[model samples]
Target: MSFSALPKIGMGTFRLKGNDARDAVKSALSLGYRHIDTAQAYENEAEVGDGIVSSGIPRREIFLTTKVWHDKLRASDLINSLHDSLTRLKTDHVDLALIHWPSPNDEVPMSEYLGALRDAQREGLATHIGISNFTCSQMDQAKDILGDTPIFTNQVEVHPFLNNRKVIEHARQLGIPVTGYMPLAVGKVMEDDTLIRIGAEHNASAAQIALAWTISKGVTPIPSSTRPKHQKDNLDALKIRLSKEEIAAIDQLDRNERIANPEFAPRWD
Candidate 1:
């Protein structure tokens, strides 16, 4: 599946909550953002649903996505949790549904969770199925479980500071798209001199440079923002293209510093 057709930029709703979450989604929608990413753990699916409803845009035109939390991986629980997420999002189906994280410690077989996701697709609860925070080996196992069912994308942390080159390359080799979750590194890359220097050439902000870098590397970027200006600024990354030389220069900024590592996250190294 070619990711060229997917929205190169998306709005990520990670830390935003309650009215703030609703307002941010609304603002992003108003600013021409068609893709919105959320999760069960975010605690704002309902608010995001409100934003979609309030936008007055047809549901079909908006590409809505949400994730299933790790703790709710049982086949029955997975189905129920997805239904709850759908109810909260005020949508019958999501464009894409992902296994929030690959909880290796959890005894549930990979087939069990992926099988439930495939069943969700069969039941028309989701249009696409994917795995997040999954290693290459885990992705291989998921592919085996999914069989012919298309695994739309693999969501992972890909930013200038933490360039996941190997994972991205592996997904590319297998024809799976990689969606970069923390393309801005939670505001850390914004202060990097390498990104700043590169951004100067394009007259773009470091955040924009980092986002553009991700896209240039063939990964879709979802940068979360509650501010209107920031939302529009992220969209501007699509307008700025980094040259090969600049791309390599910024690629050197990879320090392997990850911002979203919860104690439960898989070891990427």
Candidate 2:
């Protein structure tokens, strides 16, 4: 999919559930968020679906994405899991579907699961397919395994604290875009003096600065917030443009601190 059509900032629905998830998504859509991201592991697809429907937004107007969990990487399991996700999400087909993570301990080969994802696309269960939490090497392996099939985006944890330049560089080299989660560093960015100082100049919040930094790198940042004001603040980030000095200052803050690492995580490149 072209980056222009894909939302530069999406509403992430991780850890949000029940009324909170439903209400947040509804409000986000009302506030002009056309892209919504959720995962099978989040276990709130049903609520998310409810929010989308409740918002009175046509299904075609929203770009919905859901991921398959690591445990369900087997071909049959992957396919069945997506069917269940679709049912819960109340969508005939998601705009994008991803392998949530690489199989734990190599329990399932990359080719097997990726092929199954392709099969899902062929079945029209998802319009596009991609992988998440995959390292540079795994990205290459995925591209090779899928042959001519396009890998849409690699969803991973990216924030000012964990800039993830190497993976971003690699994905850029491949002409693949990235989806950055935790763009605010789980609220840590708000405390950074550098970000605060930069935001002061633009009348923006530190969170907005961090988010703008992510977008400036050409990565989509999916920051979630239940409060309408914060949600609006996140969406407003798309308007904040950072200068080379500010971006370089933020880049110097990377500590390589990863927040989404699991036992199954591929070795970082």
Candidate 3:
């Protein structure tokens, strides 16, 4: 998908569950968020779908995306799991579908699963196809396997605390836009002294500063919140335009602190 096709800011539904997820999604949509992100592994697709439906917005107006988990990377398994995700989401198709993670230790060849994702696209299950949490090397392999196919975006953790510069740069070189998950660093941004100071300059909250900083770096930041007020606060981040010096200050905050590391995660770029 073209970079212009994707929303610059999205509402993430990662750790949200049940009514929380439902209400958050509904509130986000009601508050004017057009991009809604979830995952099969998040176990909240049903509620997320309910929220979307309850918001009274037409499905066609929403840019919806969901990821197939790493455990289901086997060709048939990936396709089947995505089918299940669509069912839970109460949608016939998603705007984008992604591999949640590369196969642990290369248990499944990139060709098998990526080909299946491409096949899913061909089957009209997802309008766009991409990957999440994939490193530079794995992305290279995927590109080689998928050949000329386009990658919509690479969703990865990219906060000021974990700039993920290498992944961001490599992805840029390959022309895959980066969508940052946990752009607020899971609430840590609220306590950062630099962010706090910057927030004061614009009369914005620290969270907004973090999102603006990430946006200034050409990364789309999807920050999730269970509360309506916080969701609105995140949406307001788009209004913030950081100065070059402010962006550099946030850039200096990166210390290789990755918050989403999992046992099965690939060696990062």
TM-score of each: 0.97, 0.97, 0.98
Error of 2 at 47 (Å): 0.3
Q: Model 2 Cα RMSD, Å?
A: 1.4
Spell out the clash pairs found in candidate 1: none
lDDT of 2 by residue, 62-97 (tens): 999999998898999999999999999998899999
Candidate 3 global CA lDDT score: 0.92
RMSD in Å for all candidates = 1.9, 1.4, 1.4
Q: Which ten residues in a row have the lowest lDDT in candidate 3?
A: 1-10
Q: Which has the better lDDT: candidate 1, or candidate 2?
A: 2
lDDT of 2: 0.92
Which candidate number has the best lDDT? 3
What's the candidate order when arranged by decreasing lDDT? Answer: 3, 2, 1
Pairs that collide in candidate 2 are none
Off by over 4 Å in 2: 1-5
lDDT, residue 159, model 2: 97
